[model samples]
Target chain A: MKPTRVTNTIRALRFAHDEMTQADLAERIGVTRQTVIAIEQGRYSPSLEMAFRIARVFGVRLDDVFQYPDSEEVAP
Target chain B: MSKILYLGEAVVTHEEKRAWIMLVVSVIAYAGYVAVVLGRQDGGSLTAVPYVGALLWTVGGAMVASIVAEIVMGMANPRASRVKDVRDREIGRLGDHVGQAFVIIGAVSAMLMAMAEWDWFWIANVIYLCFVLSAVIGSLAKVIVYRRGVPQW
Candidate 1:
């Protein structure tokens, strides 16, 4: 199966937001630090609810946090 | 304070390490049981062998070893830092499902052996082997899943 096309701005956002550590973000999002690392590295994709939760932790909209390159290409 | 330096970078996540411990404990326990049983067997039918004591000892020992290993791992890592998240849950379920398949197979085989009037020793050993296979295979699956990213589905 093709790899997940989902990507996120978690690393950049974390840096922009007071240089937040991965553990700090994980604690805020109620997930393990390793999970945060995986998401940052694009090895795992979070569920929609988790995606919204992550974005909420950073005080951003869902789209601002995650992107789908395939969806973008399909857009008219 | 001096900076800590290691010869090589060895990094294993807490879950992965737990899986490894379980795999090792199960294999060692099962091997020990088999060795003792075979060593005690005289020039007689396998059905005459006394296997109950060995089976019980191995089962209990494996349980204790697994518990002790988990405790040691917990002590080594800070409790607050050890977290089980979505990926961990998914991997656990996947491993459990794979292991459970062996359990059903073993049960059916034991039932058939019993119907055929096979030796009680064989039936009991088959059941014990199934349990061990479940644990070893399940732990192995978990370790592999942790190493290789969880299936996309």
Candidate 2:
């Protein structure tokens, strides 16, 4: 599968939060650890609701957790 | 030891393990059924070989095997979370969509065969084969998605 255009700073955020384990973040966000891993790795772009939930877990704005490349940068 | 555990952790998820178990059990059960039916074909027509009992037993056995395998997996990996999250649900839906194509093909084939007055043996076997194909392909799809990561459109 193509990698999701949406990239995230979740790993960095997790690190900032005392080197939080993926499992702990998952628990806080009500998702499985693997889902957290997928989001962190940019393998899966989450649903809007899930995106909000993740942002809530980190106590950050959604943009702080996820970003998409500028349209001009992605064009061929 | 840490490296090995990390490697194991990186490789598979609980859902992937279930898919692997389903794939293996389906293959084994289908192979066993074929072997028994073929062994009974002692110079008689393949269609004439009694197959109903074998089919029933194999189907039932596969169900039991899948249940037992899941139980054993849970026991072995008690630490692994059994809950399905959003990603798991999406993957399952996608895999089922892929597998359902075979099921529809099987159903249509059976209907046509019945209309043409084909032998019951051929019709039954075709349905059974499709069912096995559905299981094999579905679980295989799930495993691949788990490895490759779910496509986010």
Give the winner by TM-score: 2
**Lowest lDDT 10-residue stretch of candidate 1 chain B:** B1-10
Cα lDDT of model 2 by residue, A1-76, tens digit: 3557889998888777777778777788788778887788887788899889888887999999999887755556
**For residue A29, what is the lDDT in candidate 1?**
87
TM-score of each: 0.83, 0.89
DockQ for each numbered candidate: 0.25, 0.38
lDDT of 2 by residue, B102-122 (tens): 999999999999999999999
Q: For every candidate, how close is chain A to the native chain A in TM-score?
A: 0.86, 0.86
Each prediction's RMSD over C-alphas, in Å, is 4.7, 3.0
The regions of model 1 sitting more than 4 angstroms off are: A1-3, A71-76, B1-14, B42-45
**How would you encode candidate 1's per-residue C-alpha lDDT over B57-96 as one tens digit per residue?**
9999889999999888778765535567887787789889
